[model samples]
Target: MCGLDHHDDSLLEAMLENNLLFDSGVDGLYGRSGIFEDVIERFELLVRRLGAPDKATRIHFPPGMGRKTLEKSGYLKSFPHLAGGVHSFEGSDRDHAKLLGMLEAGEDWSDLQTPTDVFLTPAACYPLYPTVAQQGAVPDDGRLFELSSYCFRHEPSKDPARMQMFRMREFVRIGTPEQVCDFRESWLERGKTMIEGLGLPCHLDLASDPFFGRGGKMMAISQREQALKFELLIPVNSEETPTACLSFNYHQDHFGQTWGLQFEDGRTCHSACIGFGLERVALALFRHHGPDVEKWPAATRKLLWED
Candidate 1:
């Protein structure tokens, strides 16, 4: 209800009443209803089936990652505002007493908590870089990983498509420039086809991340100019401006140089990743097909529920 316009409020009510989502009474943080979880599971299975021939290495990471890796990933430089650091109480009994008093009095008690070694992961691919770098060099054909994680961002909005915490399923490829670039390009089309198969109207478009400040603005422009990022957008909340349900990115030696990732040939490995926003995609399906899962199109139900 916080700053949500009439349209968003109505949509939120519908979703809540349908039991597709459970609001935490906080913007951007909501619990998934049973149907939501079921849909996500089916979607992930569908994604895995689509990529089965690729034989990508599957890896699932926890919601948080080491702060050091986040630093090394250069996330702070670009998305400092969106990054979330985990913190916990690390004080003595006296501090605990004070914290309790403050909490009881409805005063600020967060100061007692200190930052931990881990930070909430910002992307599905962030932790993969350091782990891959530890392996020394990539193989001749390079490495491909299927990664998924719950990513956290600080941005909160009335638009349900934009959530502070959401799951991202990504396929990461590392190899020569051509190899990585080709991987990204292939997924660009593949993503479109998969979404279309679900009967969702979508389009791939040139896009860039929302960078932080003045310097970030320049970085965003440079990224777009280099054609490094693209997103598959679908109309979720509005038709005029669509939400990005999937994204493809090419990091030309940026991560390689940062994490010492290299090819067997003594050259830095270029990397590309295709990420699917699981929640957004499910939400898109719900918006398009209406709330009742049993009433959805026969083809859609068969595709999701049947083999």
Candidate 2:
């Protein structure tokens, strides 16, 4: 939505209208062309405009990360429904031989093996938390880190926008609670302003996290009550359906306590993140503006291709 030109939206809508939505995963990424390049450039520009300080703090992680790291950060305990992990053979050589035989006989269930340590990263922020923690305490003041990470989830729905794997560009700020909260709030406003300025149909809403189970349900409620997460939703494929393009979260003492990160006064630090789903926004652009690149607004196209 931020980087697309007016005619670009028309072309996208036309493609979707013609049922040309390529299943980027499971089936695989194909026929992306300039559409993808534009998306990346726009995302970078958007991040820069969002006041990320500079590119030095930026990081890029492949779609997958280790399961142990995610588990240690309480990802499974919170959202086990979205958790995904790798499995491997656990049997002896004889058992392996039997399994291979089963496979040759077309009766194998090799997919049932228990996991080693690999898991799909559910969010861009997940991988960064432990890295920051292991790096030792936050500076005497604070630290700002940005990342454009490809993340994975298991919501295998038919929506082209909500793919199993997607991109997330985020800015994480870690420091004291006050600093973290302030940073989150500031980004919330900034996100809204930028979206509005771009003429996208969006709204800033109080958000509830998808915590797991009854206990997690209570935790989610309590977290929202304490103003821990906020999201910006915009209509993408359909007016009835709004995509969550941006999420602002305040992890008040959560990561800090878990990781032993300290501030200037030696108190545990707090953390917050501002995240954007790069692909989802691209989908939104298609929905709102249509898909003909040539027909896209000159101003918007210029902004996207500027850098």
| Whole-model lDDT per candidate | 0.88, 0.73
- Sliding window of 10 residues with minimal summed lDDT for model 2: 2-11
Q: How close is candidate 1 to the true structure, as a TM-score?
A: 0.96
Candidate 1 per-residue lDDT, tens place, 89-170, comes to 9999999999999999999999899999999999999999999998787988999999989999999976778899999999
Off by over 4 Å in 2: 1-21, 24-33, 52-56, 89-108
Per TM-score, the best of the predicted structures is 1
Judge candidate 2 against the unseen true structure and give its global Cα lDDT, from 0 to 1. 0.73
Give the Å error, residue 273, model 2: 0.1
Pick the lDDT winner. Answer: 1
TM-score of 2: 0.84
Model 1 per-residue lDDT at 306: 97
